[model samples]
Target chain A: MRNSFKKVYLLISVLMVVMLAACSEDETNATSEKSGGPVSAKIGVISYMTGPGAAYGEAITNGFNLALDEINEKGDVKIELIIEDSAGKQDQALTVAQKLMSSDDIVALLGPTLSTEMNVVGPEADINGIPIMGTSTTAAGIPQIGEYVFRNSIPESLAIPAALEKAVNKYGAKKVAILYGNDDLFTQSGFDTMKAEAENMGLEILTIETFQKGQSDYNAQLTKIKDLQPDLILASALYNEGAVIMDQARKMGIDLPFVGGNGFNSPQVIEIAGEASEGLIVATPWFGEKDDPKVQDFVKKYETEYGHKPDQFAAQAYDALYIMAEGLKNAGVADRDALRDALAEIKDLDGILGKFSFDEDGDVIMEPTVLIIKDGAFQQFE
Target chain B: MLGDIINPYHLQIISFILINIILGISIYITLSSGQLSLGNAGFMGIGAYTSALLTINFDLPIFLGIILGAVVAGVFGILIGIPALRLSGVYLAIATLGFGEVIRVIFVNWESITQGSIGLSGIPHLGRELFKTFKLTGFDPDMLGLKNNQFIYLLVVLILLLVNILLVWFFIRQNKSRVGRAFAAIKMDEKAAESMGINITYYKVLSFTQGAILAGFAGALYAHVMAYISPADFAYHRAIDILIFSIFGGSELIWGAIFGATFMTILPEALRFISDYRYMIYGVILIAMMAFRPQGIIDVSLLKWFKKKLKLKRGGSLGIGTKKYN
Candidate 1:
């Protein structure tokens, strides 16, 4: 019994020591802000550094870190960033947000990757009075969660109409079959926007079929669409499922031109779909091929550092960090409320995404550029 | 010194641990009767949504909302248990698992009610609101300039303590009662239990329903504490987590469930330093534990040793403190 008690005590002590070590590690990181700095802003970044959304998370992290490096090197204002991984889970996102709010003295929070997660954590940030800037959350009603919640990414409601109009006018699309993943907030909202836009554009509506996210088999949906013989298929799916759906539809001999939502704006979609991805059109806030020097510089620096072209997620994240920095400079005080007000007041802040400004609801107001995949590369659609 | 040692972050983690302990114990109630259920999370979801809607839409008091939520979930539990408890072993597990999926689908598709996948937010903080309702200005930590989370942590710990006491009492009382023997008989041999005039079906369903009620109670508290909950929060993943907690702690004793839930909840947060590799390490630890100590981290031998150390009397009750059964 005495021996067992000794073992238990030893085990507890080891655990306590490990926990203390972890706490101390965070403390060191927290205090590592450049000393002798007159003005320093501590920002917390919540990204999906692991899980299904890790790819986007990594891009956001890389973008933010790159911006951090450039800002610190410039030496105008020192900003300390503490990055936490939510792993694309709402509970983890909330936990990290709470940790950042209660423990760390953060002026702002950034990225969370998914709108679903943002919806969960956004209100908490609002209650805590911390400004949470979502870089990639584009679903509806996100900014409506709280005044403190903000997103630099353009919403599907604003971007999808332009793309639908382009599809109708440029391609003479009349009959379109709509396919969307009903489970995801992003894709479902995308489908809603597309459906609304299609109705407004006076396009013939074919049968609308829904599938769950992560479902690979689309033969049943495609077969049904094939019978309808629509001119185009409107797909609202992430790159992984979008690639499969396009490939499957083509293989099934349903060679209709596809118009996709924001989720289809990825190199992975083209790489996965291969020849099938040709002529697939999407509307996005950021197009890497833009001749604007700011866009080119960001793409060049990102490509040089990450060994690949920065996707929309990266570009938006890069701009998001810059926006936060801009807000910090504008507020001139490292206070949460001041930073939030400053972020809300942001207008015509030109960055990679072009003349970015936050509307009254904290949603980005910007014109989306239409692009189509040709010869395995995204180009401006004429 | 203790207050200085534990910061707000640690308090938050502790509150989560407490909530999970409640979940673990909820699953343990069903496992005690040898009914392997996987629908506790569905019941949790029902409780969370019900309580959240009540508080957010109707302006009901937080505690009242939580109670009503649990009661509503309990009614649904009975509804599910009547049909699901008819099956046994893996078949019963599958039925419950299917029920959990159905609940998820309903939550996702019923956009009008649940706000769909976008999820419901702006859930009022329970601790601050409860303090305000009671007019206990002095005891209200939020009013006293302490963080709202600290008050919530204290509330959660208090609830955990109350739950532990209730579980201990229920386990002790039930073990001596006729219901406990009937459950043991059904688990040991359904035919024999039937021959002994034990109503196997009734006991099984009762055990399942009771387990669901506990889970719902935990869920209601969890929703209020977190101040936000999504349907995805109570998916099959959460069911698996609850199952792991009960099994890893050894379902035979309530203390086992407590230890299992507390350890598992805190382990992930503690392993956060590893970041991406944390889940990998967690899987490894689970495998190691199962391989080495299949009976669980808290087994009969440990309980026996503990009882001896405390000089507790033997054989009065068949609850966690005693070693009458494995």
Candidate 2:
């Protein structure tokens, strides 16, 4: 047997040695802070850069990169980003948030991609008084973490109601079947919003079914919905499952207008569901076909830069950075407390997402464009 | 006596290591008896949610919440252990794995209480609020330096250290006692151990409960430190990770858990220098370590080497004695 007391002492000594060895390296880190910008901030980004959610993270990064170029060229805010991949895990997100919070120079943080991550990272950043904004975290109750927490992406609580109302108005439907992936926070929150809204609008509930994500067989749930003969289907699911659910419903010879929440705001639904996507409807704060010159300019610049059309994820992230720049410029200092105040006070900010403002809860206040899938492409729902 | 000026980044990492060490030792308790129970992660979940909810809903003291959390998990350990008495080897592993899944499903489906998949966030920052900011005030750490988070992290580390010391004493003492010998006998041959009047059922259930209690505490500590948790954190992979900690560290001794957890936790941070390739490299390193030292980092040969080098009247639990090695 080993000596317990002496081993404990040895453990402490070794840890102390590690600390001393670490301290000797001089914790002075040279930042990428450029000279001569009235608005200077170092922002940290935690994203799912290499996971299944990498598309969202990559788009956000691309958007930020594009926005940074424009802002730096204008010579107003000089921002440096220390981006870390969270790999879609909350623990990793928390770790990176702590890492970012430790540094005195990083004035702001952004984009943990998903609402679940923001649920973890948001509070930590808030306690530390760092302003953290989510570009694509659209689930409900994110900003409730603290005043420092903000999300520019429209939450499902708002987006779902709008889509459902539009679908009701168009289809003149009185009864609807709601389907959602039960295992995800994102989908659950969306489903909650849909249920509340459907009840509020006095639509009769036909059936509600829950399915697990990554499980392609939705026959069990769809058959139940099919039997109800509901006028429409309200779905809250990621693209992969959403597409299959739609495709399966169509194959089962039950074609009904499908109203989807924020998760359906992607081209993958169309790519996967094909003809079933024709009547698919979703509400979003952004669309590429807006007739505004500014929108065209953004889309053109984005396409040229990345060789792909910038989707809502890229657009929201693009607008989020611009919004941060505005907040920094208005704050007139790099202080986080001052930045939070300035961000809170922001109103009538214009970007690719159009006129945006922060509500009292730091959630985005903006009008969303309701869109419908027509001929395998997103078109304005008239 | 170097001045204690450390960044929150490093402090956070060290905190994780300490928390993981608690978890490692937790599983080590179960493994010490040669029982490979995988339900520890589920027990951890039970503890984390219980503590988090108690503190969040009832405004209980953080300590009370944590203790209550652990106690609730221990209760569950008793429940699971009763059923586990009939199974062994892979059957026990599968049963425990199923139990873990059952716990996760409960957390997910019980949305009103568990918050579903979105998880519970903004749980009180325990250490931060618990302790007053201490200063090496005369020192020149002007991070408003080390005045706040550093003290918080230090206290959390100290808590983990205290837990560690307590476990070391208990485990070291237990290892030499009649109960420890009974465990060894049971592990070697259950029939023979039972024939020797060892009371196999009692000891087996007792080990499971002890594992649950430690895991529950680890869970409480993790929830408070990170201030966030979800069903996802305590999934099947987590159960596997808890098992890997003891096995990789060398299940032959308790130090194996300590050293194994420390090395594994730090390995990821150390590999951060390699960026994205780090996880791949980490996998390779683990594979290499296993290939070379399947018995673990603290095998019989290493202990023998330590014995020869220390040259003491008798090497105790810590492997450190009053004698000078050099």
Candidate 3:
């Protein structure tokens, strides 16, 4: 029965291969015939819609959809948004980008939230001549790929130095210790930038430590930093690791204050770390509760729909789509080249996050703001 | 039926199914021999990186690079397999896992060669040439140009199907020969088989090498199709997923790998419709399937019913009754 089962299984395998080949040949025959007039231009947005990093992805989507909805309502030009889930995998990102680029209707692409995915899809974008503007890829070398690729979010190089400068000048902390996540590109890049800036500013670098992403224990690294007895601990990590380390640091009776990059912006970090997150300092381009009129409108609409405030990711993505929409309208040509030119020409556009313009390499030029967590409330530094 | 067959999305899906078919068949060799290996992902990584580097850096012909990639992966498999021949089952699985992890770490840390975690870019499109006809054929390149996605999908499906057919024929021929008896005896009891004068290590190493060759072939195809790859693409999680799929699809069957790959690839897409609840739903579904049908969905137990259903649809009740009896 087992041998028969194995033979039958092999037969089925043979059948499946035949069936798939037939399916492909059929598609090839179909591809030989085609033509269509452009209707409403559809823009395919590929992002990590669901995964370990789903929350951040969801935020980017929320911001993007908000912009799309507003633009469509105005009816200046008909634009449709088609979304594909990257699932935070490199292969999926490239596949989704290729599918989008192949379609004539899709004028632009909006995401692939992480820098790792950017590496996969960037080549496709450059080759296919599709404009792909990212929401939150802060990798140092992303913009150098091509003219078609643009990012509305400020790079970590710009954001980290401002945060470090704040820690040195405002908090008057001379001795600083650093703990960062090595696996994540954003965290690693932020840590490298902060380290370089700290050395340049003449701050005493007491200790440098690293941990992997999705880690729950940081007792060893935190204890090592505590022994250094630095005035401030700068942690560069996502919410999961940052929360665990902060909670453990408090339990270990380390009273030293903590400062972090954008990874600390999640409210879930507070919910997870509890009292440990109090007096935690972080920096980001967008704050959900900021009183700025543009930010206020975005926060109000987002809360009304999702029953929560927008995070920096959501704000950046929302701003990204709006920027792309504005570029599309300005370019007036729905094809790739015109959109690329229009995006490159963007200057002083006030977004929910900040007033931004693409630099020569298609990176957003914006100042980073520092925020303080006091009694579980995020407050912009005075 | 026509619409379903001709849809580019479905073609892409089938291409992946074919790739999975190749990997699954290769894995069947090891599974039938009662040896578990987790290092197939390593072979795949080597194949992908090798083919990608050849096509991008060396400007070699795509077909030649793909074959070379498989050869390179096969060589690495043999190299790794010889040292790992002493291990079995769980120990073998652990060794293979360690091997895969070491390769991934090296690919990430060795920036000078691999471009680090940033990954190599500007990989030339291999599939595009499949649609392009030479001037002798009187084909215009502009009008005949295939979208990279379509070309890759078709290319992958064609190559994988051809390789799979060849493998099936080879295995079938081997089954009737002395080699087949040797492999079966070794599978039954390695020590007993060894006492009977069969070289246990040779067959074991052969299984690992063959499996690695398929994995490498699949990886090479994937690199060209996607035009980019990173260390994370071949992470331990992916290795585990492939193994889980193999078991879930019934490792004993050559087609189970395809079943598992197709299931996993489309399963996530189907789960995507459920949005946030997809992962939770996936775990529950996997548990339920395993509990009810551990032999897999395509086992003999279901084959009888499936064949009957096919006959019923083809010629109605009259033919279906006769088919069922047969």
Candidate 4:
């Protein structure tokens, strides 16, 4: 048995050596075949398509796929999308990013949903000189990763101040309570911005609380917040926890209007929190109720296709694909560096997200519309 | 085929398989001595973070960082093993699971160094730095008539591959030693081994420390290859994966761990075509594997059965022996 095992091992080692040589030759042939006319720029997306964060993934896929179909039909500059599910884990996201890089020949990458996954996947794509754009990664320090990384999603550092200012003025609230998820980069950055902006406006912070992502019970945190009796609540959390916190807070009769970070832009908060979602406010680049012809067309088309209205995730993803399409058209070739430079040079373009453009640091520069949940859908705060 | 092998993405996967093999063996070392730990991932984290920090902060050589990381993990193994060794079976598992969580919590809170849950990226990768520091001018043998320039990257991968293969072979052959027997004796009957003056405590701790060192080394390589390390990477689930690599591969032999690590590492990526439902399929396969082969995918009994079958076929074909082996 031992001898047979040794023989088998030797056989495998020999086979491996032969294959390695064969593989190197195979690569030469492949490179030589790439001298043809430009093909579609293959863009890969890493997303939280499963696990607890699947809602974002579902919306992103719907939005992008709808956009992809329209863009491919237009035939200006052809594009193909391949999305891999990260399941909200950093390791899985890294593996998927590598897998896409190795096998698919993706010209660019889009997202892995959360900032944590982007934190892992961004540098990898950048290191390999792959143009990676983020649709929803809003944490601080992402643009600082490398030259190849870009994000269309507004970072919390910019969004939270606009949100706090709007909510305070509209509600005439004096004292505020801040609640956030401490473990995640998105929420932590949002909380930091919220605190600074709140103090900047001279609003007294009555209390501050935090919870980890995927934690079901926010009762303890809400109980403490209730005790503080702040006139208004400020929260930075993903839709999953944000809804539950609002639900439980309303149940506890703390009934003050809540101002939130980017995570609350999803309509799933309305679905989950139900009646309690009323008076919840969030600043967003993409508004489903926008009166613009482009925005209305998307909202109507997305509703017909998906049987529901587009949320922030859907709208941003829709815009993301369009942005990439424009970049592909300008570059006129499906190469990484050309697409990256083209994308960087984008000054302004009309989309669902308004005049979308990449700033010098590759972060999005756009004004946000502060909207409050009224009746059911989000409405412009008066 | 050769082209696919040279793809940086495929090379990365190959590296992960190699790293996971060491991790599988890490768990195997403890299990062979009737010891159970669900904390190999924590040890791996220790090695990764320690090595990563040393390299990032002090600009130490990668090799030195790896060695220091392994040492720290080994010391931790002894410290943890001494107290935790008193418990047996499930209790030991629970205790070690707690150890993994504690390590993760520490990593999450140690924001200054670890950079907290967001982790640190652009971590001076091994391939880039190693190639820069060491020129393989003479070493780049255009082994199969490939271009020397193209083969440089392959040469680095080949070196790492050869080293890992040797390590796997060493573990496979190491079971014949006296220490291996001591482990076997302790597992079979602890009291009997103690009666024979084996100093069971020493042997148990030795196995634990060995497992930790191996995991730590793998972690150091993992840190460099992934170029990113986060607290979430070493959570309780990852420890479960290390244990699964041993159990699913056949914990009975060292070969089992290697097979388990290789197969399991490849399985998820192999199922990548399934897209959204791949993880569900992965889970289903695990369930099916456990149901059909409870002893694992590789074991001594299965090998012996194969050998007997081979012998019968050979004898029958040659018409040399008419032995009626049922």
**Model 1 regions more than 4 Å off:** A1-13, A20-38, B1-7, B131-169, B312-326
TM-score for each predicted model, relative to the true structure: 0.91, 0.90, 0.82, 0.88
Flag regions of model 4 displaced more than 4 Å. A1-40, A102-106, A171-175, A199-206, B1-5, B135-156, B306-326
> What would the per-residue lDDT of candidate 3 be over residues A1-382, giving only the tens digit for each residue?
5575566557656745654454333112122111332224667788887777787788788887888788788765556777778889876676566556656657788888888888768866876788888888887778877878888777878877777677677778899998987655677777878898889988889988988767777889988887889988888887778888889999999877787877766787889988888867777898777778878888899999889877788888888877877787787757678888888999999888778888999987887788777888778865
DockQ of each: 0.41, 0.37, 0.17, 0.31
lDDT of 4 by residue, A1-382 (tens): 5575556547545644644443333212122124444446778888888887798899999999999998988877667777878888776787778767654457899997988788778877776788898888888888888899999888887777887887787778899999988777677778878999889899999888878878988889888888988988999998889999889888989889988998777778999999999989888887877889988999889999999878788888999999999998888777889989999999788888899888888998998888889998789886
Angstrom error at residue A207, model 1: 2.3
The TM-scores, chain A only, for the candidates as listed are 0.93, 0.91, 0.89, 0.85
Q: Could you give candidate 2's per-residue lDDT for residues A62-101 as a string of tens digits? A: 9888888888788787887778778787767877787788
lDDT tens per residue, model 1, A198-266 = 898888898999899779799999999999989888998888999999999889887777888898789
Q: lDDT order of candidates, best first? A: 2, 1, 4, 3
Residue B42 in candidate 2, Cα distance off native in Å:
0.6
List runs of model 3 lying over 4 Å from the truth: A1-40, A171-176, A199-207, A229-232, A250-257, B1-14, B49-85, B106-117, B120-125, B128-140, B143-177, B266-285, B299-326
Superposition error at B294 for model 1 (Å): 0.7
**DockQ of the two-chain complex in candidate 1:** 0.41
Model 3 lDDT per residue over B6-30, tens place = 3345555556666666666666677
Per-residue error for A13 in candidate 3, Å, reads 13
Q: How good is the docking of model 4, by CAPRI class?
A: acceptable
Pairs with steric clashes in candidate 4: A22-B2, A23-B1, A23-B2, A23-B3, A24-B2, A46-A112
